[model samples]
Target: MKRTFHHSLPAFITIIFALCAVILAGNAISLYNNLLSLRNTNSWIEHSWDVKDRLKNVNVLIMDAESSLRGYYLSGNKTYLGPWLTAQKKIEPEFKAMAELLKDNPVQSKNLVELKALFDKKIQLMKEGLAAFNDGGLEQIVMLAKTGEGRSTMDEIRLQVVVMESEENALLAARSGRFYQRYQIAVAVGMAINIMALLVLVLFYQLIARSFFKRLAAEGELKASNEHLEARVLARTEQLSILSRHLINVSEQEKAKLARELHDELGSNLTVLAMDISMVTEKLRPTEPELAERLQRASATIKTTIGLKRRIIENLRPSVLDTMGLAASLMEQASEFEKISSLQVNTDISDEFDKIDPSSAIALFRVAQEALTNIAKYAQATQVWISLRAADQGLRLLIADDGIGITAEALKKSKSHGVIGMRERMLLLGGNLTVTAAANGRGTVIDAYLPFNPAAQADASVAG
Candidate 1:
């Protein structure tokens, strides 16, 4: 259950985070749309106000023209013409502006057109009344006013202005309502987004807290289990290490003993048997040819057996290793490998370790020996380089092969006991061994470092 939750927790967190991101993004887009709509509504409201103001101005100007014309007819004063001419000049642009404004609304546009026609008629009547006063005095003006055409036209213009104002008022109300709606929606979206953010944060925090508490509860148990397992593993490894070291010592002793016995007993016996067979063959050869031939065959067989025994002794414990030291033994091994494997063996042997520790010496030799054997069997190389040298008050033996490089995966999967045995030998002697790719990246290099002071076995600090 714990493992399943641990595996599933990341997916859960990812989904929550994705949801939060989407919510925030959606809120932003909604807010932008609301603001845009609100701005458009506001502009429309201002436009309605402008159109209503222009319509009122048109009505007021037409009224001013009619009033001025009546005052001028009554007083025959040129000063009354000032406001009449101003109204006449102003109402045209005013009507033009209103027409431009109402062009989008068919109903308001028709009303504005009627209003313009009425204002034009009122101006024409005003002009005619002035002309009548100039031509026939007060009687002509009275005659024009009595017909009541000017009064009716003025009334129609007022009515048209009222109609357009009513339309603008209705449009303004609708736009204002829509703006309020968009504003409320924007406010609600903002609040919802904020609330969602708070909830997400609270949920995330609670999840983290719960997970932390659960992990804290299990931490002690996990630590105890790990400690117990590690203690057992450490104890088992120590025992195995002791057994391995003892076994290697015992094996070396047994091999040395067997080699001595073979040399002393079997070698002497075989030499005596060969000597007796040779003497009998010469003596009894002419007397009995068949017997002599049997004697010669037996002598040859005995000689072959002696040679085999000698080789076995040499392999068990090389005499040069005991007498000439590590370097000579390693070179002999290298020279022998070169002959047997038909591969190039370049040597850089040092005489610095002539009086080295026997245990250390054998460990180094075994590492080289094992590595060279692996190279012959597995490396399929054409050339090998062997180096035994002193480095940082310790012995460093390096062997490299220009063969297919070793891979980390191959090392992990390899089950070669020679590698294990060589490692164990070095660990027993406070030394370290490493196998790596060659510097040129096309081969394998083996490095073995044995510290003179066994306690100072830091891996690479004093190693070459």
Candidate 2:
């Protein structure tokens, strides 16, 4: 429990710290957005005021143009025209600046357009009157002054300026409200973040203590669960062992039964065929040498077929293992294996193995069989050594080769059916099997040991 607590404490604290950081980071982003909104709102509010100032400047320029023209006309002085010319130069530039600023606002842009037209009309009226007075058409000037067209145009220009100024004032008011709203949100978020950080710092230790207890409980539950699982696993393994042992016995019995059927059925037929061929060869005419040779060849082929059938039956169950016992069977097996695989097999088998249990005898023979088969297929060896020795209460069989050695990975491979079978058979007999590299890692070696108890065997036989 203490070990688990030590292991989990650091991890738990790290998780808590990460969670706190995420919360803080998310709130910090919110606060930053609030401040950003405030900044944008203040910027637009200042822009609206600047736009209002431009509008006022434009209106003053228009008024200056009207007043300067009249002053020049009435007083007959060129100095008054200077102010009008300066106003004219500056007015169009102001209108272009305001247009650029209010382009994004549909209402304001429309107002600016209308206001520029009014100012243009007012300037045109003033210019005509001045022109008429300068041309010595005093009557034209007087008539224009009487008609009040200049007065009405100036009035319209004034009204248009007011309209533009009103729009900017309304935008300024709205931006001001927005700026204050964003300021309030930023303040609230900052306060909330501070409170959350303080609470996290205060409760961190208490959370660690609670997490330790919960972790301890989980560990205890896992321990008990592991124990129960182990018991169940052991029970299941025993059942599988029983099933595997039963399967091996059934397979052996089936092989023996098949061998018997082949011997009784095909063996008799082949033997009769050989006898009939011999009889036919003796009765053939003296001049018919070809027919006689054919009869002799048929007889010889029948004899070879019988031998082949016997060899196959022996391979299936090995009657020699049961009849002459494991020692003689191993010798016969080695001799045949030499002829087929072209590898020399040296044996040091104990004669006493023949007196042992039949099951142990067959198991040992099968171990040798499987080992030799593997050596032939994969070992690439020129020589093999087979040894059987009495050790303690069991007999140990070792089959080693002088070929390319086995790999540790191949020995441990789960899908190696031959290796698995030999191991399981030894395990069924309360023994074990091992495969390894030979001396100097030159080739592969298989070691199989089976515990023997004569009394137990007798008792088992009686029980059976």
Candidate 3:
């Protein structure tokens, strides 16, 4: 049976698509969260920058006022007062901006309030001292400006402002760091999501391909199994036919055995008993010379009957085969055939003989006997060679006769039951028998090869 790939493909594709969709959805959620975190970080960074810039402006105003006061005291310069006044005008706006920028923080708001009060007090004191100086009280003005009390108040106020600015800068740095970390995290998460998505896609593709391949493999296996089953069924049918033929052959052999026993053993004994009775009757006759002649005829008749009986028994089953094993039995049969038929027979047998099952030994002996009989009766052969050898792989039996060789057409057309029986017996014992014309048209040859190792039967079982 041919198989198709489309049978399970749709289901596999659908499952892969579902898995990929799930992975894509998960990655999208991760990316969205990362983006939100990054946006919040950017907003915090922008606000921190604004606060830092306002703080810088406030610091510049305070520095300008301090420089003006120092110049006025050092050289008693009235022109420095002009710059001081301009700085004073700018200080309020800078302070207000700082206050507004830090309004969200309680500590910074309190520090701004204290700074404002300190600034106002310093400005008022400077203005009053300036007025004193203009009215010719310069010494007192200088004295007041340089006093520890005024310096202490200014120091406290500057320290408070510095603390507040420092706090604000620290907060700004922290927020900047946080913002940078969030941005980096967002980028990392996005990359991770992208990588995961790619991995999922690859997995999905592999799963789909694997599923298709598995289906194809399964279908191929099923087809091969079916083909194997059909071949086995056909082989079994052939074996059954061969078995039927074997049963018929066995029945015919049994019948032949029974007929030979009846004709040889019992018939020969009865004939001998009758011959003895006839000799006695002749010996009792009135004429003594006639009795001698009749007795001599009876004795000759008894001898001929006994000889016929022995030949019949031998034909049915050879006693040598029962006692001497396959090799000796074959040699004895060949000698008897040559003596009886006036045919030249030659034999070559290996001394390395081993015991085999009685049935197998008998079958091989019968096959040899039949081959020799056929050659003697029909081949009109003058010379025959029989060889029995133990080869490396198995035992081999060869019988060749110098006779009128059979043509290929005759070999094909002839329905020779003797050869067929020989082949069947060899096949039953896990062996093979082959018949071919000898080289140069010298004779007809028969070869029987049988394995010595019975383990070869296991191979036949496994194949079946």
Q: Could you give the C-alpha RMSD of every candidate to the true structure, in order shown?
A: 49.9, 43.6, 57.1
TM-score for each candidate, following the candidate numbering: 0.47, 0.50, 0.44
Best by lDDT: 2
What's model 3's TM-score?
0.44
Model 3, 149-268: lDDT tens digits are 667766876687678768777876787687678767767876876676666657667776887899999999999999999999999988986886578568547846875676665676
Candidate 3 clash pair list: none
User: How far out, in Å, is residue 141 in model 1?
Assistant: 99
By TM-score: ranked, best first: 2, 1, 3
Off by over 4 Å in 3: 1-232, 238-260, 263-268, 271-275, 278-282, 285-295, 453-464
What's the ranking of the predictions by lDDT, best on top? 2, 1, 3
Between the candidate structures 2 and 3, which one is better when assessed by lDDT? 2
Identify the leading candidate in terms of TM-score: 2
What lDDT does each candidate get? 0.84, 0.84, 0.74
**Candidate 1 accuracy as lDDT:** 0.84
How would you encode candidate 2's per-residue C-alpha lDDT over 155-175 as one tens digit per residue?
Answer: 887788778778778887887
